[model samples]
Target: MQETGVKLSREIVTALVEDATAAPSMHNAQPWKFLFRPSDSVFQVYADLDRAMPHADPTTRALHLGCAAALFNLRVAAAHAGWEPVTRLLPDPADPRLLAEVALAGATAPENDLAPLYPAIHRRHTSRQPFTDEEIPRAVKDALSGAALIEGARLVFPDAWHVQTVLDLVGDAEGRDATEPAAAEELRNWTRVGAGAADAARDGVPDYAFGPRGRHGSAPVRDFAGQQSVPGRGTAVFEGTPQLAVLGTPGDRPKDWLRAGQAMERVLLQATLDGLATSLTSQALERPELRWTVRDPQSAMGFAQMVLRLGYGPSGPGTPRRPVDEVLDIE
Candidate 1:
């Protein structure tokens, strides 16, 4: 066998990992680890089981989704660094922990100008504030739909009636979760708010991202502030009616979750690039019954993986992230 002596430099590897870490994760858990083997020039993506949110994600679906989003970012970063990332998903059947393996092939220029999206990566966040009443233009919606399709997922924008149905279902999920001691306790542990020493803590959704206490007759937005003892974390009249998109896949499986996660980030980054504000509400999708209902009856789409709200409004404050050192592993 002939040996092709191609090598991946450490600097390019570090740059790619840095961009990967910027991808969003549920509650910013960043539940992933990357192992790079220079001998074969392969980067192995692994799920950090310790960071999994067991209560909300018993099957580790959400965690896999998050890691997959990071993996996508790694590919884009590699592309920008002049390398084509050749990816293998679920490379080992027996070892389910190994999510993917990316080999660094020779560089190939991105023909379609994916460079525009590279900027929105770190800029995107889960905006909880009610978006302005202004609706997103049809063109923008179509563009985002394309983004979802590219990542092997479908974006369903519910009409007025369907939108209301989704909101109601999410409201029910929020109310039930509020009263359920186990669910509420889990939320409390992951929600960090208030000032002083503890505020410096890493992980969990911060207080700034929490917009106002629960409002009456409003779109369902997760009120992390309400879960905290401290009250009054700013207020805003959330857009009375905002566009919602349901992201779904044809099948329900681990690979589907990863695809959904990548599609979610793709849509989000495109929205950010298009000068639109966005927020995600997975409360309804968190429950199995509610999840099935969120899927558009008209489409072949299965249970929805996420519900996203889009509009023109102020960008939410930046949420803290664990330094790259914490999430990225070098080997």
Candidate 2:
């Protein structure tokens, strides 16, 4: 990590940020910025409020979740680079926009655990495509739950009835998105179809990543196209029994949201390492009125932060990300 053991170079900083920005965000809205202070080797993460989804994520809970996931990736990158990441979330009360601050210090002991996940950082993508009905192994499921728990969050694999509940909620939310002008407009604004997707520089959900519409069964893939005609988009039958997991924390504060973000990414990365395709949907949790009901009454989890679709199938196409220069600055 320290080529000269004296100062950190700009190239290294940019690379770290590049890995950081690979995190998933609602609508592919990479809503985070990084400031690298070379003097102290500290990177400051801030939420780019402009990239926030106002209609779908009105409270910016999803925005915070995205930023925090980016922050978690930074930690993994730093560890893989042989620098210990010392992170502080919501570092400034005066400036609520400051989501996290990470100091990259030399590690005396190697980060064996985090370094392994660095590879999955690149391999893991949201798989909007249909997955097989094959059940995930018990050991793999346990590992994923452990990953979330390690980051101060809980992952609950709901029963059959609860899975149906989640599917129903997604249907309800999607219907609302159609009827509500604000949500429909926001969805259009965030999606790229036809030429828009092919020439997309960065950000937003490209049509290719939209996956096939679920012709049959209970897959919760969001139709990013809404009603627009994507010339080459195809439709396919999805899994009848889609395996879903709910990631949540006891509290719903900004800090808690940040922790849940880290937990969610860790689970995704671990799942990737274990050879499982994945996707995410929060339509049910996005609507405030329907959020609480998404959580199972029997579960100890409080606020549902994310709903993950996991299985063994084709991983979704990679979405575009803003260039490091566009989102990162050296001070």
lDDT value, candidate 2, whole model: 0.89
Per-residue accuracy of model 1 over 1-331 as CA lDDT, tens digit each:
1122447666766777878877777777788888887776788899999988767788888898889988888877776666666778888999898999888776655573455578888788777766777777888889899999998999989899999899899889988887888887777777777775236956777776676654543767777655456656555566667689999999889888888988988898899989988888888877887788899999878758888888887787777766666665566
Instruction: Tell me how many residue pairs clash in candidate 1.
Output: 1
- What root-mean-square deviation over C-alphas does model 1 reach? 2.2
- Residue-wise lDDT of candidate 2 within 16-56, one digit each (tens)? 99999999999889999999887778889999999988788
Q: What's the lDDT for residue 138 in model 2?
A: 89
Candidate 2 C-alpha error for residue 234, in Å:
1.3
Which prediction has the highest TM-score against the true structure? 2
* Candidate 1, superposed: residue stretches over 4 Å from native: 1-11, 110-113, 197-199, 214-217
Where is the poorest 10-residue window by lDDT in model 2? 1-10
How does residue 49 of candidate 2 score in lDDT?
97
Off by over 4 Å in 2: 1-6
